[model samples]
Target chain A: MDNQRNERKNLRRQRRIELGTQKRSPLGWTILWLIMVVFTIWTMFPIFWAVITSFKHTGDAFNPTFIPWVQFKPTLQGWHFVFITAGERTLRSLKNSILIASCSSALVLLLGAFAGYSLGRFVFRGWKNKDIAVWILSNRMFPPVAVVIPYFLFMRTLRLLDNPLAIIMAHTVLNLPLGVWLMMDFFRDLPRDLEDAAFIDGCSHLGAFFRIALPLAAPGLVAVYVLSFIFSWNEFIFVLVLGFHKATTIPILIAGALTSKGLEFWKVASISLIGIIPVVILTTFVSKFLVRGLTFGALKE
Target chain B: MKYAYRKHVIKWFFLLPCLAYLIVMAIFPLTWSLRLSFTKWLATIMENPEWTGITNFRDILFKDPRFWSALWFTVRFVFLTVVIQLGIGLGLAHLLHNNFRGRNFFRVLFLIPMACPPIAVAFLWKMMLHPDIGIINTALQTIGLAKVKWTTSVVVAPFTIVMVDVWEWTPFMFLVLFAAFQALPVEIYDAAAVDGASNFQVFRKITFPLVAPIIVTIVLIRIIDAFKLFELIFGITSAGPANATEALSFYVYLTGIKWMNLGKGSAMSWIFLLIVLGISLILLSRLRKKI
Candidate 1:
């Protein structure tokens, strides 16, 4: 008992030193914090400049002012131009982005869940599960430009160009493979006993899946939801080509801020923030699940 | 629990939609593009696609100087961006994995760059890199340095793309690796230390080999996505300063869409697809073996 206690004490002490919480000089910490501070500034200064520039008057936008009241005055000119005065088209695009992203992600989850559950839980002849999963992932990996050109022509042929449906269909195709691959892992990780017990209780396979496995995998679903939504939301190429006029999204709106007079810094910054804020909220919501979800569980042990 | 083979009916019901949908959307389009690759037809001008077997492929491989230059540019861009991101990101992850004062605040700040879409990120950098009125140049000049022509200069234009990409993506690499590090068993490190292993030795022998799989996976993902670099070029440079930053994706877009050379664009994109597929396969197979 005495030897065991001493060994335990040594182990705890070793952990402390390894974590740099013990036996570290102030000089070392100062350098670490110094690196952190520099990294933070590199990460933030552009955004800090943008935040100030967004609120600055168009005339003051060129002045390189970091402070609002002292160095320069803040105005709503940028916000007003992007929202109030020329706001009609901008609002329409924001609505379009939200709708297209959500709708397509929902479609992806709907089809992907069933497919994922089937692939995970059941066996099919002539189609290996591993090969099927890899095929879906390979589709996801194909360059979007390859799809966009052909998709542009196809949408035009179908008279669906510039319709939100065209963009929605495109997003569903891009994200569904990812959804299936992610959801398959989640469903496969769930215990078979609960599902089997439900089946023994006269629950049909579909019933057991709907009542048991899905609730258990609800947390993972939220992860895939946010992942797909963000991909669909931030997408520009498909929207640039297929959703050209009626279905344009915020990224394109920000891009459109470039005019013959050059980009109005205030205008571009405001529009970009509009595009960024939703993703920030969504990512934070599912951040804990992200390591698994974002990497398709490639890092999962 | 011997469930009936009858459930195979339901199983196919669940799986067939995804397969059918992908076939129509992915397989069908790819097949069509493959067919288009052999023809000589500008969709905008030519009424019918004229069959010209192997001509488009031959011309693109041999005669197109811009194609070779664009390929060179893309390779360099992917190499520089991935290497730099991996280096800084791994270092940051190792440092930030430890708990410290105000760590949470810095963590939250780091997450912000990844939140912005690629186009908006390019714009944010463009505003900062503006030669005269931009904050970066203003700071430089105030400290007694010459300003850069960020958009117009050939050398600086491509560098700016790499810079913006590094800033935007390093957080992703850092976050993923940080989580991987956090998930590691700390006891092993303590044991290594007790055995008289130096810090560098511990990292080399234990930490790296353990996380080697994760590194390979993220690097493979980054490389594949980096080859698809499009939004930054479109938003910031439009391959300006005389095509200095024209990526393969941009070149494909220019040839296929903007210039309306459908046949050639199709061929170039097929080549692009094959190259990406080949790299991803090699990396992916290595990853499988590692894990």
Candidate 2:
């Protein structure tokens, strides 16, 4: 009799579990669908507007109609204006931006990796190293404007104005402190056993670092590169102030377009679209690294 | 002894690149600006600067109306943007925190505005806010509301600038705060619910306090960033029909870069620098304590 009762209880419990699961699955799915719909609209609206406007003839863009309902023939004239007629200037700007952003990111990573490893591995005699790290991070606290004039004049004296190398130099100064702080955290999180084992097996410290540790920290290094690159690429103020006709960047081009009297709106929109393409593409593929980099040192293992 | 000396040399070698960049790019320029602030010089024609200690400061503080107005505008902009951005950001973060389909896509979408150039976003909004043929006016007119001049009216211009800033930057606050929210443990939330707390009560008693530090950090960062607001306002209105949106940063540009008054511009730059540094120090101490 007890066994039969137990079997009945088990059957009821199974039915309850089945019903709970059935109820939750549909509810979860509904919630998910709602979220996706709202989020897609919110995020895609402005970008859609920008791209569509870029395609529209000048008059239609000013009269602003919602996408798929606007009455106008789409034309590639804006793209032609931005890329072909202004192609030489735009291409020069793009080249300069690419060079500055790439070189600065590379330099920051190399320096940051070396210093990060040192901080992660060594302990010095004084409390000075900790203080130094703090000081380096604190440099980010200084407003960019405070140092702009000085940098301007210094560059002027050195005849580095309108030079891509000058912008790269300026960016490295701004990004290096943050890079070191972040890389230090990444390096510290890595286990010392690999290095220690390598050291024991007749490997030099440098060899252990290159052969064992550096490979292990590849993801973190990539994170640093993506972030530093993005920051440099998107940097506007220094570029605007420092770059002239010789080394104008995409941001400078966009700013100039907006400021010019009676400038073609469609052309400005087209350039804006083009300016964001690289950033959007980079962020889409490497968002994981970007997010990780932003949250660096925030989460302690 | 030899090995110890060699290790020291290697350590310094690793530090050389960064130190070199810092000294040339950061230290030298900063010192030059500080020294230039106390001297009077014209960039256009004069090579030698005449010593004018405290004169530039006196002129700016006592004589320049634009300087004071710009200072007031910056303070107001920073305060309003920080509060509104943080409030909206927190709300959106909370709303989106639960397990939902398309959360990942939503997260990416929310970050889109931040990733795009600020100047581009500003220009887009300017197109939308245009009075005669703009969509915003058209929608209002369709709904039987009178058309409002957004950029031309001085009173409306600063407000429009604020709105543009909010539209472009609220997403940034949302992204950062969402990350903070995700870092929160679920067990504590469950415990709150078990104690007969409503969802709102659970959020108030548990989630809000847990996220306060991050919220403060975000606010502080926004304060510093807002003070640097230039591109958007510059693009949309160029400090407006009546200098309504003439922020301190823009003012510095006008005085120094446009007007060629290096002495006054240097003074203004120094003042802004000091203010930024002071606020930054406060934030640094707060962050340090939290960590």
Best by lDDT: 1
lDDT of 1 by residue, B95-115 (tens): 655444564455566777876
- lDDT agreement of model 1 with the native: 0.83
> How big is the positional error of residue B134 in model 2, measured in Å on the Cα after superposition?
3.0
Number of backbone collisions per candidate: 0, 1
Flag regions of model 2 displaced more than 4 Å.
A1-43, A68-70, A125-127, A259-263, A289-301, B1-9, B287-291
> What does the interface RMSD come to for each candidate?
2.3, 4.9
What is the CAPRI rating of model 1's predicted complex?
medium
List native contact recovery per candidate, as a fraction of 1.
0.58, 0.35
lDDT, residue B161, model 2: 87
Query: Interface Cα RMSD for candidate 1?
Result: 2.3
Per-candidate Cα lDDT values, in order, are: 0.83, 0.75
Q: What is candidate 2's lDDT per residue for A1-301, written digit by digit as tens?
A: 9998786556544533433322456867677567556645655666787787788787777755665444777888889988899899889888887899899999889988887777666664575556556656666666676667777777888899999888888888888876887777777889999888886687876788789888999988887887788778877878877878898887888887764476466787788887787878777765655544443233321
